[model samples]
Target: MGSRRRTPYGPGNPGASLTVHPLEGCRGIRAAGEVGLATHTIWEGVLEQAVREGEDVYYLELSEVTFVDVAGAGALAAAAGRLGAGRRLVVRRPPPALRRTLEAFWPGLPAIEVTM
Candidate 1:
């Protein structure tokens, strides 16, 4: 798997970084680091790529991710919304707050499935 890294600085947070790695045996990505305003572009880009891949199920393995803001979670939900019927985004081991944010704002959304 190839690894790509991005570091975007935001106010009061200079150490912000996000790394995305292609999964070895699946059509998905595993991400690490923080997802905030500064790193959202990369986050959105990955999500868009997943959507364009047109797979029945796309995986986002985020167990190593440390933080995800509301907007980041919103971006994920939006990406899932773009999928065609019977397709879904499978989020694995995402941060608890990210899952809460998804449930709080986009309750019962069918296109996104979260697994701990």
Candidate 2:
């Protein structure tokens, strides 16, 4: 297992960081912390990397994710849309905020599947 990287968000609060770590026994990663303007880029990069790595199915465990802003939600939606044929982006146990954000902003997105 790899170590967790702390990615700081926003300009002023350098102390506030997001923890991103690789998921064990799966072709994906888990993110814990706030997903905002400063941290959304990290999410996009991770998503693209997962796609590039040829993972037929990508998983993102967002149960520990504290918050999701508009840009963060967009990033997730875009990542889901980028999957190729027979590929999927499974979101496992997403937090209520993330679920509600997806439901309110992007209803009926075929690529993103939410499981309990």
Candidate 3:
């Protein structure tokens, strides 16, 4: 186990925030509001820590995410790739912007699994 340092995106803001929730033997994160460069930077670090501490399966619930820039999408894809085979980084309920970004720039990244 490694240290999980709290970032700005971690349970700080009430308006736009990212929270980590524990799933059944796995870890999950929910993101809200705009996922641009600043927030994405914090989010990327949080996701990296989650992946480092989580089990084989990790979940990123993006249902409340309103917007995601290219960097944010790239961060997501990077995390997915870092997980490698036999591990899963499932993205749930991705917004249209994120979906389009992934389809356009990262069409061949099989590690990123988007659902609903």
Candidate 4:
């Protein structure tokens, strides 16, 4: 098992940090941010990395995310569609806004997993 680093979230963190940890052939994407237009660059890079590595299951840990926008949701959909064959995208936790967006756009795409 890996240890979780103590990183503060919000304006103080500026979402400057993201850890891509691979476990049991699965990728863990831990992000701390609002994940909006301003931080889309980093989010984009993260998505690219997840795709490039062809993670079997992209476990996006967004429990720390306080907010997310439509662009970000779109990115998730695009990334999920572009993932390697048989690989799926799993979003462990999403803000209400993002969740609603997912329910609207990807209502039946089981590839995008939403957790309570």
Candidate 5:
């Protein structure tokens, strides 16, 4: 498994950061840190990688993520939308607001499954 890290500068928010690590024994990733305006690009890159993997079930283990903004959740939904039929993205332990944003804006999306 490989590891990547991105720390984007945010005005008055030096802690804005994101790290993506490939999941062992699976075609997926485990991400940590905050996903907001500053870290969106890295977040999207991680999602893009997941899509490129073309696995039937892509897992996003985000239990360690401190926060995820609405746009970040939107990006996740958009990435899941790109998957082929019968393919899905499993989102594990996301932030509460991020989960709500996904549920509110993209209810019943077939390609995304949220789990605690």
Candidate 6:
């Protein structure tokens, strides 16, 4: 729940723009474009890096993320679970269309907010 920071919006390694930025004491991760079977490895890598770095809270600024498949969502959930109770994974400002998708598949997700 800090200020929103503008980041690069485009494709990343392997056609997925799964971007990340370490906000000093905070671990702010911004994942855009798509995340699915084609980019699950990238997604997992981002989460792993956050965990390994011992980030207290992994703020996944997912507003710009265009899509998230089952495997992608699972990867996120798995990472959050791995972090345990004290740790947090915050997702912010998702696209207008993904609401129904989030509700249908991952309804009780924690740390997810529709900021705009």
Q: Best lDDT goes to which candidate? A: 1
lDDT of 3 by residue, 1-116 (tens): 21123334422242443443444444776655566644655577757965686467678778876777787788878787777567777788988878989999989677677899
Please write out the lDDT profile of model 5 over residues 72-112, one tens digit for every residue: 88899999989999999999999888889888999999999
Q: For residues 9-112, could you state the per-residue lDDT of candidate 4 as single tens digits?
A: 43334543433344344566666656665566667777777788765777888877777778888998888888766888778777788899998987877567
Q: Which 10-residue span in candidate 6 carries the lowest summed lDDT?
A: 1-10
For model 1, the superposed segments whose C-alpha errors exceed 4 Å read 1-8, 11-13
Instruction: Please give, for residues 1-80, the per-residue lDDT of candidate 1 as tens digits.
Output: 34444454653257787889898898999998888867887888899999999999999999998899888898999999
Using TM-score as the measure, the top candidate is 1
Better of 4 and 6 by TM-score: 4
Which wins on lDDT, candidate 2 or candidate 6? 2
Higher-lDDT candidate among 3 and 4?
Answer: 4
Report the backbone clash tally of model 1.
0
Q: Which stretches of candidate 6 lie over 4 Å from their true place?
A: 1-25, 96-116
Model 3 has an lDDT value of 0.68
Worst 10 residues of 2 by lDDT: 1-10
Quote the lDDT for 41 in model 1: 76
Q: Which regions of candidate 4 are displaced past 4 Å?
A: 1-26
The clash number for model 6 is 0
lDDT of 6 by residue, 46-82 (tens): 7777666665666777766787766666676667667
- CA lDDT, every prediction? 0.87, 0.75, 0.68, 0.70, 0.84, 0.61
Write the number of the candidate with greater TM-score, choosing between 1 and 5: 1
lDDT of 2 by residue, 56-115 (tens): 788888888767777777888888778777777888888787788899988988888888
Q: Estimate each model's TM-score.
A: 0.91, 0.81, 0.73, 0.75, 0.89, 0.65
RMSD in Å for candidate 1, one decimal? 2.0
Clashes of each: 0, 0, 0, 0, 0, 0
